[model samples]
Target: MATQPVTTRIVLASRPTGKPVAANFRLEQETVRDIGEGEVLLQILYLSLDPYMRGRMDDAKSYAKSVEIDGVMEGGTVARVVGSRNAAFKPGDIVLSHSGWQSYAISDGSALRKLDPDAAPITTALGILGMTGFTAYAGLRNIGKPKAGETLVVAAASGAVGSAVGQIARIFGARVVGIAGGAEKCDYASREFGFDAVIDHRSSDFASRLEAACPNGIDVYFENVGGHVWNAVFPLLNDFARVPVCGLIAHYNEEPSISEGHNQLPTVMRGILRRSLTIRGFIQREFVDQRPDFYREAAQWIAEGRLKYREDIVDGLENAPEAFMGLLEGKNFGKLIVRIAQ
Candidate 1:
């Protein structure tokens, strides 16, 4: 009889207080469990590192359950079916699964979405053609509702969701201004992503440049990095402007505080009331019904050269924790992916 394969996995060692570190994750090896009648054993190929995973590390309540101590670090992954007891999948089939930070995972074949390499690169199943792209599409369609000749601003313009938001808004005939951290990223957002204008948020005159870029008051704002960027954009929003709150990467590391001068709720509420603005926060899963529409349109746009995406891949599962930490600090150029297997 053949010996069962040994699987390498990373589990949550301790919850992070502010920023996650290597000590928060523990690596271990265990035998791959035998599949049941309806289960499939998956060999993870690519692991996606996203900002939302940071929120899950805390013990606080959120839209999703936290990653319990000693459990696998939660993430989305693309994998290959290595062994299957289910008829829906075969040994060589590639699939997208939420198998987290592990080399092997067992699934009941229910949550697996089979992937076809011929349609698009398998890694895209975890990136542009997947969650991030869907996030951009959903936010715009439901809340941002950008219209022709209107101006839209999105921060982190060279990133997965921001890049998509910019390009998609342009396709909808809206003037798009993007904000990125550095000169290189700003250049890419303008030249590669085709944003009408790109501002380097690190510039000393970032607010001035952003103001100049949007001569017409911003009609829609895709809020990604919500610290200083929000401060610059708030005053420039047109009356009845729509704001889709996507992420707050800048504030994720902040500890709970109500210190004087740190509270902006009063100021923000006053602005909202005066401007009659519409600000809505949402999770991608809430628009799961529109995923099919997103997949079809985004795929067509990619094939037609209207949409583009980039990825920054790090090799080895052991590097995932370090890569993820870098992601929160804006260290990655594009979508951060960990190549766990060939």
Candidate 2:
């Protein structure tokens, strides 16, 4: 079959000093090149927008290299294989690939995983059954270590990772308390996501409210937002509590050297020493060897209706920058995704 000649992509137009603005991204169209011997042509369907991508915008030392100026912004994408020069994939095969911010991409197939659209919605390969879900499982299981009857608190309660952390903690018989930004999200956390208690972090009485909700003291705190939310959770932690330091969306857009408020290191250390808490920071790739187990268990829970996920999908690659900016402001309600094509 003949392939289309052109592809559309969003590239990094410029680096941002703080929060990323629309000017930082540029959308352009270019001709698609023929696939090489072991490569496949992918038609991107969904693009996953995660908080960690914010760090990649800056040219600094991190676990991964920063996206260079004028380069295509990086992300996980679910695509349909429209053409293949390889034996492993054929036309119409949906696969998970790091296809970045383009409508069509060429891949060598080594880093791509074929998907069964019949098994689950193809988009899920970028969400619940993919990297995001695995991140939640691996972090919580290895660090949070929720036990039966224990209490687990998670922020960004409606996001991909936080939602998964809450549900998985419940499966292990922990009482889950979710902290979200607004009343609607708080309701969704408690009513839809099965959280034992939901607190609106935007409330004027946020710290007091969180204290009231977590009467038994927090045993496991899945740290997603690390600003005011962290300040609130710190004092509520019980002795021997476990905290898995995940994404810190609250400070993602801020300049690395800027101080948001008065230093609280002494207070944090005091709590750590007094309560003997265990805090561990992690990146999802640390648990790649456990992907098989995570996928097996997470898929089962999703299939059995024990795990529920919500996706806030925006249309078009042009809207990605604005949608991503909203993500930092807690404007998104759930797992954020971009539907680039049908």
lDDT of 2 by residue, 1-342 (tens): 465658899899998888999999999999898888998999999999989989999998899999999999999999988999999999898889998999999988999998888898888888889888988999987999999999999998888899999999999999999999888888888888889999998999999999999989999999989978998999999999999998888888876654756778988899999999999989989989999998899889998898999989999988888998898888987888999999
Clashing pairs in 2: none
What lDDT does each candidate get? 0.93, 0.90
- Residue-level lDDT of model 1, residues 200-226, one tens digit each, is 999999999999999999999999888
After superposition of all CA atoms, the RMSD between model 1 and the true structure is: 1.3
Off by over 4 Å in 2: 1-4, 255-261
